[model samples]
Target: MLHHRPAHTPVRPTPRRARTALVLAVAAAVAGLAACQAASSPPATTSVTPAKAPADRPDRGARDGEAAGHVPDGATVFDDALPALAHLDPALLAALQAAASDAERDGVTFFVNSAWRSAAYQDQLLREAVAQYGSAAEAARWVASADTSSHVTGDAVDLQQTGGSQWVADHGAAYGLCLVYANEPWHVELRPDAVDEGCPEPYADPSQDPRLQE
Candidate 1:
């Protein structure tokens, strides 16, 4: 009975087995911590502000039912009229500025009411004119039609002469600009060749050009 059980050394756990068990437990604990961290973490992101538009972007359109100026670059408000300043061709613009400067020197009076416009802006104006006049045909007679719009080219300017349209008509050509349509003396273009090209001048009729279909 009280004979010490077979004089046994304390039954030792095998060192290798103990080490294996320790390694397994440590791995399991590490895995559990990783899961907890993942669960508590928030999405790895931050607030984003809208990017500003570029300086070269179109920046001109209509204002208060009247032609306006060139638009500044970086504008994205397509639905609304772009600010004046967007539609100037640099070569013609410089020439125009020089001419205007000379006129200023000479005390010649001219007022700029409009400049370059995006195609969409021109389209909008046509629509509004149609709405106001109550028919597409009537609107065409009253305002610039969409397809032949010189405004879309950024080479056109709607001007108000200080003296009269005739004054502007007389002086505008010295700057390589001419009235595109005889009807709208205010609508001017930079290209004189358009007259020689027999390009079906928008002055008499502004129906859509069949060539534009190509």
Candidate 2:
């Protein structure tokens, strides 16, 4: 005799199980979307502060003269664009031009290293000199006070180039350009009497100059 077999019934999830499954599916989809968003987003940035400059370092940009009268390398005495040259005393400028023209004949060009500084610039230089030399007296030998500095008065120039400076040293008297300090061979000043009486002996240094006393 064949036994009758009961048909298998498909098991249906209970209400609680179905609700739990639906909540799990929704949570998984939200997690996937959050991961995708995180992957596509740019990395977070951090803010950084710049380091402060040293207190002892000279501030070259703070001085008005540096902006208006600073002489770049290869600058000629006739560079009208630079206030260093343009602001020079009329007679001194004329003398320099004359000497520069004569120097060109000998294949030497007058390159100005410094000229016509503002009084504030001169004071800054004096402070720097003091710091470098470790004393006010030593600094005075190199840099004069703003009130006494020929640079501040637009009456002095610092020339560069070995050939050009030497040429000026040799023939400067004819043009009334005189080296005022024995220590500074590159520095020159207009001494109108030098054209007639020849250059007076240079002071041993600016310290010994009577003009500096005043």
Top-scoring candidate (lDDT)? 2
RMSD of each: 12.2, 6.6
Lowest summed lDDT over 10 consecutive residues: which window, candidate 2? 60-69
What tens digits encode model 2's per-residue C-alpha lDDT throughout 1-214? 9998899899986799889999999999999999999999998999899898899987676445456567877888878568898888989999998999999999988999999988777888899999999999999999999999888888899999557678878999999999989999988999999999999999999999898886
Candidate 1, which ten residues in sequence have the lowest lDDT sum?
72-81
lDDT of 2 at 201: 94
Q: After superposition, how far is residue 179 of candidate 2 from its true place, in Å?
A: 0.8
Tens-place lDDT digits, model 1, residues 113-193: 666666666777889989998998777754565466656666666666454345546665666666656566676567655
Q: Model 2 Cα displacement at 40 (Å)? A: 13
Which is the leading candidate under TM-score?
Answer: 2
For model 1, the stretches where C-alpha displacement exceeds 4 angstroms are: 1-83, 142-147, 192-202, 205-214
lDDT of each: 0.59, 0.88
In model 2, residue pairs whose N, Cα or C atoms come closer than 3 Å (at least 3 residues apart or on different chains), thus clashing, are: none
